[model samples]
Target: MRAGVCVILAMGALATMPWAAADCNPPMRPPANQRKFASQAVDSIIASYQPKFKDAQLGQIFANALPNTLDTTVFEHTTSGELAPDTFIITGDITAMWLRDSANQVAPYMRFVSQDSGLFSLISGLVRRQARQVLVDPYANAHQLEGSPPSPHTDDSTSTPAFAGTRVGAMGPTIFERKFEIDTLANFLHLSASFFAAAGKDQPTFGAPVNAAGQTWADAAELVIDTLRTQQASSEEEGGNPPYLFQRTTSQPTDSLQFGRGAPAARTGMIKTGFRPSDDAHTLPFNIPGNAYVVVALREAAAVLSALGRADTAASALALADEVNAGILAFGVVNHPGANGTVLAYEVDGYGNSYFMDDANLPSLLGIPVYGWTNTTDPLYMRTRALLLSKANPYYFSGSVGQGTGGPHDGLDRIWPMSMVARASTALSDQEVLSVLEQLKGSTACTGLMHESINKNSAGSYTRPWFAWANSFFGGLILDLAETRPHLIFA
Candidate 1:
């Protein structure tokens, strides 16, 4: 949106223009001395893969992106002489740490955890920080870094809604935003499980107390499960009011829910959410992709608990996962006339209403395979994916610059690079992956970094130049391709 960003985007659009060519692709990363953090494991891979890239532009972009999180966002990494060694990572251009973004920002580094003890501590510290934040407020999606200023959305009426029997709880000063997204808790479980799996440790070190109240990691997991279970109730079942209510005095329709409660839904066993992963209010109460993510996250939580020697908590997680999965199959799957087969709906109400479009967010319907909710080659998923990628899905946009899914949060005719990453990450073949890479290469508008959203017709017009999650995730995707499909990167 700044003049400098706009000029860079304009130059990126003119591929053959000599000044544009020089402006868009010049080494865009900060100098080594200026980087905020460093990792030998990540640098080793980046150094190894840079020369292997056939497209020099793509290579440059990958180099800048893969280290973007470390170079720009590592705010705190206290190693010793404290209650516990922990890390705090800020979202790019924003000081707050989102439960989902911070986890994903470091997730790609999980594979290298054992190879680097420093990296292990960095990630483990995040796990510890996330546990403490979860206990602080399970319903809030993002938290302020220690001693950071209050969140802009703190004034919203976050108390339990009128008809609920018990209090859902109040928002604390540590919370940056109180948007009640189901994926927030799911991502917390995912980070814990992924770290546990990668570290390969038998001891329950992560279960140690993180708060003065003596709440352990296992205690936070129990709270996540309890919150999800409580949200499973329908608005009508709760006497026309769900337990959580968030009302903001904003002009943007997507920013606030109607009457401080979301659209109505019936008791469908699946958890109802006030907001989607994109932080937009849902048109329907039940978000199918979100529920699918919960199913996987619940199982992952079960694995974490079982590893920590809590069999009873593990059983509860597994049982809840099964119940949610059943609800998904029963109500979320519908015979779509547009897709000409039984396919997964994006959002559904228990009264037989289903929203057909998929947003570009992580817990998207198109990300079912990547999220491990269903196999990549599952018949239903394939059909649903086909419909989603085509004109059938309203959010699926195609223009002169490139094409991918974008949601209402960014407005019409913009494509999200995260959606492109999702598509490439789930690509069944090398050619499919290559196609997305080409689009991504051309979409950066010469900044050599990923943007939150780009104009489909003009690559240079984009948003959020400093978004760390997209940059790091794009880097992670390239790392994955370098290992599994080197042919594409090397070509």
Candidate 2:
């Protein structure tokens, strides 16, 4: 997932921190059997029975799912000097911390924060750490954890095999990968607002200066808004922004942007991104789902800012959010022959070129509703969702076993579990939700854990078995199901 321009977000679930070390929310019940599918943090959670779910047949599966996201991945402790902030969450396979995945990995645990002191500190520290990383280099999607070795990708060299006019630069002291994807910043801001909300709900004083080192959550929110404003070459109404250049040396074509930069933007008010969430370079810079996500994230940011006494900043973000949404509705939606009336393009260069399909990553067409940018029932979203879930989208795939949207970052025909889980988040009938859940139960593969992308042709064939985001997200869905339709668990 390391990239200079394009990004394919990463996947995998592995124990960076052992079960013995997990001090957050140990399971409240003992195991029913000795077989353990994951590390101790998960095992402890799964073994404990929720009395509310005692009568449900598949209740245990629901319990195990979300915990899989936390225990199997996430290194609970990371410190820079004396600040031992107990948060250094890495994606399943990568040694570096992804702003997107870490925000998500810590999210499912929000329900327990009020009762779990360990978790409160863990997420709080992460909130601070993520804000710092954003301040350091908001363009970089991933960062180096303290005490970790330099990534194998630490050198700047011409990335293309052509090695045409390659330029290398010294690596930042703590950057793991510096791909400039818009969702990275959006995720950072969203996480800040989310944590602030969670902390506030837990207690009124949680994010005050005394607790947050004089840096109120509002301060972080403002920083995000200001940086986003500066990166605004996406609008035709705006002028050229600051100079930002990045380079890396590798033989892989996807390792870096082919030209060391993206095409010129028309400034449609959509923020410019060097790469898509897939971590792949976008032919066009104004990624549609990314713009949509910024709107959604800014909504959260606006609320956070308002509460933090930065009403002016809140309004600014909200205005930008509206502008981005307008850009999406205008330039982001394009007519496709043979498709329904109209559909959302995955990307628009603001110069007439638009990518007609979606990737399997978040901020994708199928994921738009999941992120709260629009309702699933919204006609445009529904149309685009249909296209993405079917063969019309190049990455959507189906075979004998299962099918979903795939990305080059994972593999061909490898449907991402996140995409699958996202389907359930939309406006679905109870039975439709059940059908999806049944598929997920079978999609876990032999490990009894969610893989990043399951094999389309064979249930047994898969990749990235230790994906905590997939597991936690899937588990979160199940928890939602349990609340809305408990019978689905038994059926």
Candidate 3:
């Protein structure tokens, strides 16, 4: 579930270390049989690294986190015939699965899919599950595991004619929360292509029918493309009301969009998003990183569709990606009053309004390179990275304990470990990466697992004690470091 506290104002900043020592003996993981799922390949990974890490604390952290999702959250079912198996993953504190979080939770296991058939089936099954969810409602971000259950958030109107009335399933118990986040859809597409590339499996592996509704991965991809295309219209272009509208009855101002539709956006070619990946409502209609992510996700979708012989759909995906990329370049870049060069705005409206702060979520400006949207050396991304890490970006915080981006999602004076992971993943040098890792070690509050957002001054104070996405992402970072710079861990 999305963390509370959407207040955008950052309070006074202070720099001091939180009193949380790294536990030499971290809590042991749950017993093997008690684990929700297990894999020999993942066991091999932990065994291989445990002896190699020069820092035992980091090693223990890796061991606990790398398998956190499998150990605690995953539920898998295997079938005997042509139908692909089914898997449903809960986003740690929440019983429902978020398309975005579930994908990231299993991402690190991609490499091991071929080595462990169990792991392969789990990931492939998740792909099919996502397709089913997409077919259920492309506008929904979080979804329930089974038949429509009671929803937690206040009822919102999804019945209006918006975005071609594609938000039809928006008002059901099947969807946990119906916030239209573009990255949620994009991540599904990326995961589909990534899964195929890793497993070397196709057709019955993915294209086989998933439900009686005739839902398949290909059908989901088509709907996602169409939804994105429909959202590219400006208010004037659409002629009447915007295509999507979200309203949640809550005291939090950011909980609901103004007048059901979000801030008005001109036709900038970028697809408008109702909310960010954080599940916070957007200050502006167009989310730059979200659009950039769509570009990459679209290209990945194109690859999968092309291989499946859907040339027309594949071509359409590629064309949409190009149009979105062009839109980002033309409208997302801005002259930063506090920076040496122009940088990418975090969010923008087609009609000259923009928000500059970056949230500590995936698809952030600082994570463009990490997201495969751009390279570190790209002048614009480099400039934006500097600005985001400095005082220029309101959400960025520095303290004696750690320094990183936080978002309005968790309010002021907080730093998210996910941002630090993104920083390390995108860093240029071994020292730079190590610095971030050291901060992370101290910010875990001796729990040995990652949290949603920790207090910049006090690591003990944080949100979402059981955030599996951050844990898995942190584990993935360590895997990457071990593979590329062994000395960082081995020394």
Candidate 4:
């Protein structure tokens, strides 16, 4: 039988109970099998740390450091039930589905999916829900899935949902609120592609009968590609066409261009531009991270298309991927004194004027290796990574608690994000990895729960308490260490 069939059969016993309604309660006297798996996971994490924490004092310190359930107060809405998924929200302090966060949050669990059918089911359900959301509006990257009404405090009013014509799926009353963030969309594509590749199955909803769900996701991805090809910018109200306008009515202004009136060539790789990965508008956006993500997405999309027997679509995606990659290499790199050599800038003007600082998000210079864009040992990447993690990169900050990257989403001089720390550890040496682990263990305000962004000087004042991305990132890092360096645990 197929994987889905087998999963359904295994879950047959629990079918009568509302599995969806179950909170992420601590595993209740977990079965021997599950305890064994958890033990393996823990052991793997410890082993990975062995090379880093070999010092007798540090070893004990690290040994005492274990990842625990930070806050059970946060929950995910697995079904159209009353609860929400206990996950992390981004810096903006909104409870919603971040395409990027959702993917990264579940990444660590992929290893166990094959062995643990139940875990696989939960992940599969999340993917299906995301696919459905994409179909609803391919342009939007973030969403509010809880069916709650809009609040006056919302920043981007353009995304507010109306009751009519909204498609509610596994998660109830969800609406598309955040628009096309190339990075988030790219991550979504990557996750979907990876899941399909691993499971060796087409998306469960690919041809299934659902309320325009499959078509929506496919069309949205296509539209995103089209937008990138044309370099579409803001609507007339936001500032008309090409040069691009980035305006956030409620936050600190990042750009001065009247939306779409800047340099044209700089905007070449951009698609259907509106808000950025930070959910802020782009003034003259040929955002480096966004483009990088697009490149990755197109490559993955090509694979997915080919897998589904759509060779033509696959070819188109490949061509687009190449185009974006070429454009980025041509315009995104610059010689910076801060980097001590040529490095990837945060944002660039095709002619000149490249932004040097890094954002806390993935595709960041710090995240290149983590995102699998390049190997960690690549010379250019290593130099760039060193600069990004140092004081030279204006966004890099350190405090008594820990050190990591920060971004415009939060504020200047803010402490780094736990997400960045987790990602950094994935690509660092054993020594560096231990340093990050020590920092992370000290940075958490609520014992072990990850927060949005911590204060640069004070670890006590963190930005958000209920963040799923940070928790997921920490979990993912543990899994990575378990897989890559097993000795770190007990050494």
- Top of the candidates by TM-score: 1
- lDDT by residue (1-491, candidate 1, tens digit) is 11122335453353443323655555776898998888899889888888888887788888888888889998888877443667888888888889999998998889998998878888888898999999998888888876777777777777764333655446788888888899999999999999999988663447667777888889999999999999888787777445677888877888788877789888888999999999999999899999999999999989889978889999999999999999999999998888777999999988899999999878899888877999888999999989999998999999876679999888889889999999998889888998999888877777788888888877778888888888888888888788788888886
lDDT of 3: 0.85
The TM-score, computed over Cα atoms with residue i paired to residue i, of candidate 1 is 0.94
Error of 2 at 247 (Å): 3.2
From the highest lDDT down, the ranking of the candidates is: 3, 1, 2, 4
Give the better candidate number (3 or 4) by TM-score.
Answer: 3
lDDT by residue (tens digit), candidate 4, 1-491: 00010111121222232222323112222244433113344345445664565443333323322322212212342433321111322322355567776677666556655565445545565566666666655555666644557632244323322355332222224543444466766876777677766666644523332243225345545655665665633233223322222233543454222332333444444443454556555544577767877777788877776767668767878888887788778777778877667887777656566777777766566776666666778877777777777877777886655577877667675665654563446455778776676566545532345567776555556666555556656666655565677676444
Counting clashing residue pairs in each candidate, in order, gives 1, 24, 3, 38
The Cα RMSD in angstroms, rounded to one decimal, for candidate 2 relative to the true structure is 7.6
In model 4, where is the ten-residue run with the lowest total lDDT? 1-10
TM-score of each: 0.94, 0.82, 0.94, 0.74
Q: What lDDT does model 4 reach?
A: 0.55
Q: Candidate 3: where is the Cα deviation over 4 Å?
A: 2-25, 80-83, 160-169, 201-203
Model 1, residue pairs in steric clash: 9-460
In candidate 1, which residue ranges exceed 4 Å CA deviation?
1-23, 161-169, 203-205
Question: How do the residues 283-309 of candidate 3 rate in per-residue lDDT, one tens digit apiece?
Answer: 999999999999999999899899988
